[model samples]
Target: MILTDTHTHLYSEAFDKDRDEVIRRAVDNGIERFFIPAIDSTYTQAMMDLESDYPENIFLMAGLHPTHVKEDYKRELKHVEQQLKERKFHAVGEIGIDLYWDKTFLRQQQEAFRLQIQWAKEYRLPIVIHCRESFDEIIEILESEKGDDLFGIFHCFTGNLEQAKTAISYNMKLGIGGVVTFKNGKIDGFLDQIDLRHIVLETDSPYLAPVPYRGKRNESAYLINVLEKLSDVYGRSKEDIAKITTENSKEVFGV
Candidate 1:
């Protein structure tokens, strides 16, 4: 089974002690391809270091995360643009509206999201969105930006069937993660209704760990737990789920 963790922050400081071991464990368990998302300018060097260490396994993206948007957002966006212009990236993402942590920068967040989406289209690269408590707001922006040129994965999707259909209408593949294994995670109820082609697997490591490790820090190896839950939800074999989701990820990341 070739599992693709389409969204993971393997460069996070949480794995400073054993990042290599964590990666090795995931790879050993068949989580082969990792699509790394950008948070902001601060983590760029760390992300680059990880890719240099594992060139064959890591695919990097460039963008400023919504939660990270602040008074100096234009500077952050400039960094994102500069990075994208300087090198090749699989996508322009982990970008979108995240009003969960704070709403003070909502306008800045929307602006950052719009600019990044345009950058992705300009580069002909896919985008990975990070929507938190602002689904409606994000959808609103996406509605205006919808077109054949604007399409990517909605990372860590936890919306209803209607919202899922809406996201798909904009050509996005829903990124399912550890939350699908939680008892309160409602996505499990209607995930089967969403076609396998419109789904992609992600770990979102260091956050949203699956059932057994629910409150603990997540790691890429735990993606297997998510794969198992998805198998149960779709009534498909784990191997089959992994294969299809990996393909879905490839379609989004072009890797």
Candidate 2:
């Protein structure tokens, strides 16, 4: 079985202590692919180092995360554009709306989001979206700018069935993470509304860890919890879950 964690911060400082060991555990449990999302230029070196250390297992993406948009977002977009032009990236990603943190950068966030989507379309690479507390606004932007050519994943999807359908209409697959296992995550209620083919597994590690490890630090190794939850929700074996989601990920990242 080959499990693919479609989104994770393998370069996160939180993994400084024993990152290798944690990754080894994930590998032992069948995780073979890890997609690392770039937040900004600040973490570029760390992400590069991670890919350098684990060349075969890690794939890198270049983008400015929504929350990371700041006063000089043009420079940030330039950095992202330069990186995209100079090298190959799996996707233009971890980019979307985040009204949960601050509304100050709302316009900037939408600008960055649309600009990144343009880059993705120009490059013909898929995207990975990170949305929080602004689904309506996010949908608004997507509806305005989205077309047949733009497609991607909605990372850590926690929305209801209708939202999932809306995202799907935009050619985005729903990235199911640890949220499905939470008592209040609630996405499980609509599991049957969407099929397994439109689903992809992700840990969004060093962030949203699954239950039993909830409130604790998340890591790639914890994807097991997500696998178990998916097995239950989809009524499939873990190996099947891993295989299908891995296949779905390949369709997105073209790995």
Which candidate leads the pack in TM-score?
1
> What C-alpha lDDT values do all the predictions have?
0.93, 0.91
How much lDDT does candidate 1 score? Answer: 0.93
Each prediction's TM-score versus the true structure? 0.99, 0.98
In model 2, the worst 10-residue window by lDDT is 141-150
User: How high a TM-score does candidate 1 get?
Assistant: 0.99
**Clash count (model 2, backbone only):** 0
Evaluate residue 153 in candidate 1 and report its C-alpha lDDT on the 0 to 100 scale: 94
TM-score for predicted model 2 compared with the true structure: 0.98
- Cα-based lDDT at residue 225, candidate 1: 97
lDDT digits (tens) for residues 1-255 of candidate 2: 889999999788898999999889999988989999999999999998999999999999999999999998999999999999998999999999999979999999999999999999999999899999989988887888788778889999999899999999998999999899999999998886798889999999889889999999998888989999988887899998888889999998898
